[model samples]
Target: MSCSECGSPTIDFSLPERYRASLSTDAAVANCCTRCLTVEPVTDADTDASTPEFGRISDAVPTDQEQAIPLLLALELADSLATNRDAIESLLRDVERAGADPLLAIDRLARDPDLEPRVDLERRSHQIEQLLYYSNN
Candidate 1:
């Protein structure tokens, strides 16, 4: 089955009951992909949940700063990862040294079409945010 978010073909059989309860009868067994669900996680609302949606800062119409939200999230994820730890950490220090706000930096990128993270990175960051939402709930 295809993931509701990324449209990947991977499947996740071990969806928690809360997640499963959120699905409709038509797609109880095959809904979102593993990478976009269990591995990366995704919004239940994106998969057709009747529950009220909440906590999506980017849900409002995309703005200059809103668009950069993904890159900021990706950088945060990179900061947490072992491989990109040093580079992203150094970059974070540079951001601090320059007296730059990361959100402002992202907003600048969003305003500049040519300077943004590639589409793939943006999508991954959004997906990660979705996963984070599920975890928080």
Candidate 2:
């Protein structure tokens, strides 16, 4: 998995699920170094569901972490939504400014490539979006 353009050497990685969906589907992903990014089909994603497959014969995939993403996000959003939209916008601006440093922590996990977060940020985002936009009347 070397850099395709530079041939600067590369390695296989078990990337996070958040990155899996962000690619090919979201515009925000355009900012990253796309050349090195690896996007797997949903069925082949190295998610929690992919793990226990080695122990069983069935093909059912496991669900994402139950509460990790939703709790933090809900808490944060509760705070944000409590404030005026302008205040929330300003908080987002501050977050954007603070997050410019792409987390290199992922690079450090080259050895433990299978590590996945407990909160399932990808699934949580989807749930939150549904809760916010789709009324269950």
Candidate 3:
């Protein structure tokens, strides 16, 4: 089924029996939109519970792989830079001079459109926020 938020195709997954009982309705499955990440419970009649759908979205909708290109590029760059101890030290010094936390600097780099133009930083802002929260904890 399509997502009500972004109209992107949704991936369906079966809810465990324990969790199913908590819901008022007898929905054994839930659909999560791959793009917007919106999740909603779906009954068996709304979808085929036997086989969960995957990779059946329209061509116009960007696939997860396509959306990950910028992240991949950023990760590759970070990995390559990690091999250079001097570069890492220099980056640390720069961040220190700017009076910014190293982790926040990394988050800013990830969200910088000029650095990774293809990345939808706005859409992934929550992920960045979570990363910061977890790292602090």
Candidate 4:
């Protein structure tokens, strides 16, 4: 990865073992862009036992909350960084699949420093419920 500030290559960080265990599937990984210092998410399908893992990267970016912001931001980042439409769309679905509660989405949209959108929080919440129902199929 490249730095957002100077266009230099960026570094990556990983989630710790304990935190990874807290996640549902441990199928996504976090990366801090070197250029922008932004936290980026990548699906864990690309990962293997050879990949490095760690605890949370920083307190400035904690993973304890059921906040939709992380999932939303990760989706957007995935779209922007992805190579093709198919890949981007896949990431979008993942975002919708993994995001937090509608209330959390609303709260983040209302207060996030990045001004991310959460307008459809109620509808999306309902969508998630329905999706979950169908997923049981």
Candidate 5:
């Protein structure tokens, strides 16, 4: 499903079993947009019983790895840079344009021999790796 706010694709996830018992049929499943991060419940018609996989809803979502990598990079950069919204958006656009693999880029930045002694590159790189690991699993 697509996000109403940004028109970006969404990841569908089922509610936990404990919470599911309390929800009505209409609220059993929910989807969160990959880009905008808007979350809303899926309607009965949108629900599919055939796919019942639990946890890590992203696995079920068909995402473009090329696009996802840049988006993930943007999020990590924004957090690490602690920049304003406009600056974050600009950085995201730049990363998207560069189309470089985020993991490799972050690793390279972390290991740059002549890098300025400002923010902790190694810490940021580790956080990004953890973020990717947790999100995928």
Candidate 6:
């Protein structure tokens, strides 16, 4: 079956033994495409009887720098929008799916001396939180 997130047909249900225990069913294999699995781990709750083996993506924890980097970049980009409320809203959802700590990432971004204008980091961070919360709800 195709992956739920990216719809790629290359599904490898028999993931390495490491990822197997985390998953329950052969049918409910984490979507084959590494990109989908990499984005977030699939949890039991995300699976069910009817849907294709690939189910909802969970806020799987980021294990290392490679995993964390994309989330960090997504959080940073979320802060600066050039209009397009729709895109902003979409990006907010993507950031939420990323499952990174918005507050921490925003604070770090704000504190960066490299950032040209470092004004109102806290407020911007709060805005990001609000977007995440509101989007999720």
Question: In model 4, where is the ten-residue run with the lowest total lDDT?
Answer: 53-62
Each candidate's lDDT (Cα)?
A: 0.35, 0.27, 0.43, 0.37, 0.46, 0.40
Candidate 3 lDDT, 28-69, residue by residue in tens:
776655554444678756665445442332222223322322
Across 1-137, the per-residue lDDT of candidate 6 in tens digits comes to: 45465554422232333223223233333433323332223445444323323222222324332333343323324436433334444444444565645456556545654332213555666665666565553
Residue range 1-137, candidate 2, lDDT tens digits: 23334333222223334433323343211111122222222332332332211111111111121221112122233323434333323323332344421112122222223423232434444343444345362
Q: Give the clash count for model 4.
A: 13
Candidate achieving the largest lDDT: 5
The positional error of residue 42 in candidate 2, measured at the CA in angstroms, is 13
TM, every model: 0.26, 0.21, 0.35, 0.28, 0.31, 0.33
Q: Rank the candidates by TM-score, best first.
A: 3, 6, 5, 4, 1, 2
Q: Which scores greater on lDDT, model 2 or model 4?
A: 4
What residue pairs clash in candidate 5, if any at all? Answer: none
Ranking by lDDT: 5, 3, 6, 4, 1, 2
Answer with 1 or 4, whichever has the higher lDDT.
4
- Which residue ranges in model 1 land beyond 4 Å of their true spot? 1-82, 114-116, 119-137
Better of 5 and 6 by lDDT: 5
lDDT accuracy of residue 68 in candidate 1? 24
Candidate 3's TM-score: 0.35
Ten residues in sequence with the least summed lDDT for candidate 6: 52-61
Query: What TM-score does structure 5 among the candidates reach?
Result: 0.31
Candidate 5, number of clashes: 0
Count residue pairs with overlapping backbones in model 3. 0
